[model samples]
Target: MVAHEADYEYVIHKFETEYYTYDPEDDSEVKPGPNTPDINPKDVKKLPSSFIPEVKNECAQIFYRFKCPGSGLFHCILTGLVFDMTREAELLYKIIQWDESVLQPAGKMAAGPLFDIKCCEDAVRQLHFPHCVKTQEALLSDGLLSVAHFTDDAMSFIKPLKITDTHVIVDNPHLSAFGLVLDFLMGIWNKQVKGQVLLFLSPPNHAKQTQNINVLLLPRNIPMTEVSKHHQPSHFILVPSACNLIKNTTYTVHCPVANKIQPKRAEFDMEFGPNYSPTFVIRLPMNTDEVTLTIRDQTDTEVWEHEADLTDHLPFSADGRIPAEKIMVMLLDILEDLNDEEFKKFKWHLKTEVWNNISPIKENYLSKADRNDTVDLMVQTYEITGAVQVMENILKTICRNDLVKKLSTLRH
Candidate 1:
């Protein structure tokens, strides 16, 4: 065993098949140290017969020694006994912990697929490590049983997650859709561990500018030290559903490590692939913020009904003032009481008195019963507020008190 020093930098190397990937980012031959011996496959050896019992009993402290070409330093990792070897080289084998400011020395070991070691920080910052003593090796070894199926087989031996309790509170309809699946996953996870797993899923809300799944997993009864040795809270983007535009449509839940392991923060993606799980689809309308939404299926049956915004497509001010064209619709409804000659006389008075501008309403549109043309002209020529003021003046001149009241109520 070597003592760790604060001034020394530690480097971890991945062991590749061709050659131990001394430096994955670099691919050059490493020169040997002054007293270092040659490394060859023929010269590789195993642990002594005396240590066989320790290895078998899972009491052996295993260390992987390799040359680091990047910093020209020898690296030694204290990989705990009973590690998965199939994908060992790809794992982030360096284990350390933050002691407020600097990363304190923790045993270097490989956590299997079921386990993870991460740095937990509210904001992204570079992890600072205390100096440690560096150790190197000259020779290589073999005969360590490269077992790979340890974690997966162990987890598979237990029963999967299930929902048995009926007292679970499910208030949100969208969450209710995912109740069974969450119960299943939570059950399976809770069985392996002592704590209860809570998955909080917040779907995208266009009005709120939430365009992705914001899922958070909180482990009840689990210690912070245990959690710090595993995953950190992160934004897990999921595959969005194909019917995304339609409101209340349940999108399938797709996340990283969906099959191998449970994710602390998982994204429910909508992309199509082998990893796709057709999860629950909520029952609601496509446009959530609208005042009313009606969807009729091919059978003429209503599939969805929700409130929709009536003025969403209208050309009106943000404060609800209707444009001249919309005002014309209301005016026509009121003026239907006038006879054709009387309507003509009213238009002549409007053009000559109220609206004395060079560009006036055409005679034919006003003389005829259809005032669409005159309304369209007014919309283009005047602001809704100005047009309504002129309309109030015109109504007063004609002694149309009833029409004035109607316009007042319908103007906005």
Candidate 2:
């Protein structure tokens, strides 16, 4: 373990021979390996008590010729165990009430491949245990053998995390379609553990300035966590943000941890490999923020954009005081009609709701010809109206946040 910590990049040196791999990543089972350790029914007693039960139960006889990818530099021990219904229920209870703040201390033993037993009392006797001072007592006692599977996600001298449910994001360099990782993550989530799937990073080459992450719920027993578009709420976890003001930008998150007014917060930039799983804090403006937007504009509707001075943008002030009354006023400005010609240079919307809600048409002011002609004109110009609607739909796209893209899609 110490060696792996220092250089995890170390090549697995052990030779693989005659073993099978039931890979969790893909549903596919790998072909068995060659030149590997042989542990079968006959060799079970010869196995050391000091060894993990997985080494005893799931060796060559079951896995026969299992292979690890890469060169002969990695050495991994994948073990499986069998447990009764009693252990399964007990283990489930402990995991739910798990304290997020501290590491859980379970005896460093893992159980695998559960089953029903002839008797709960006899089942407890056969369960494997870790080395401990009171281990003999713990074994003889109820709790240790009571639980079937012990998840020791990884203990550390420092704070450690033991995780079970995982969603992997492979950093595929050559793949073009970006939603593939989310598609893959969608594969693992289910109702058994209604876990929070937070994707920490993004696919490379894809540039979306605002982090586009979607979380979803897996319907009961349905393994896939579909992109919950209609019912699910995808909120932007706000951070104190400012544009182009070049210092190492920082913000005070109203941290509720450790009640001392301000708890020291930490930051994590994305690294290699998978990005989907239950996580504490997710990184913002992920690498996928790297997209190029080609603006598409309508012939009738003009658009404009301004890099508003951050000093003036409301909610956040030059002198940071977010006033109570300012919320509605600020939101109204978002709906305000800015028909300035400069605004035409950017992007535009029909503002239909605002137009309709503000007032009903004043029919009395209209002549008979004018009244009938207005409706007639709209009907005659259905093609123009369709073009405008198409333009409005295009601007509604998320990529419109990018000025360049906001311009291109709005263009012919």
Indicate which candidate wins on TM-score.
Answer: 1
Report the C-alpha lDDT of model 2 over 1-412, residue by residue, as the tens digit: 1011111111011001101211236323111234212322123221211101111112111111222221111111112111112221211100012231232233322111211222223212122211111122212222222222212453222110111111111111121111101111222111111111222122222353433322211111111111111112232111111111101112122212212212122222111111123212322343332221111112212111112111111122222112212322222232232233323321222222122112211232112212122222111122122222333343354234343333222212
Which regions in candidate 1 have their CA more than 4 angstroms from the true location? 1-326, 354-359, 362-369
Kindly provide the TM-score of model 2 when superposed on the true structure, using C-alpha atoms.
0.17
Off-target runs (Cα >4 Å) in candidate 2 are 1-42, 45-119, 129-208, 212-280, 286-412
Q: What is the C-alpha RMSD of each candidate to the true structure, in Å?
A: 31.7, 26.7
Cα lDDT tens digits, model 1, 177-220, are 01011112111211111111112122345564432222222222
lDDT of 2 at 77: 18
The candidate maximizing lDDT is 1
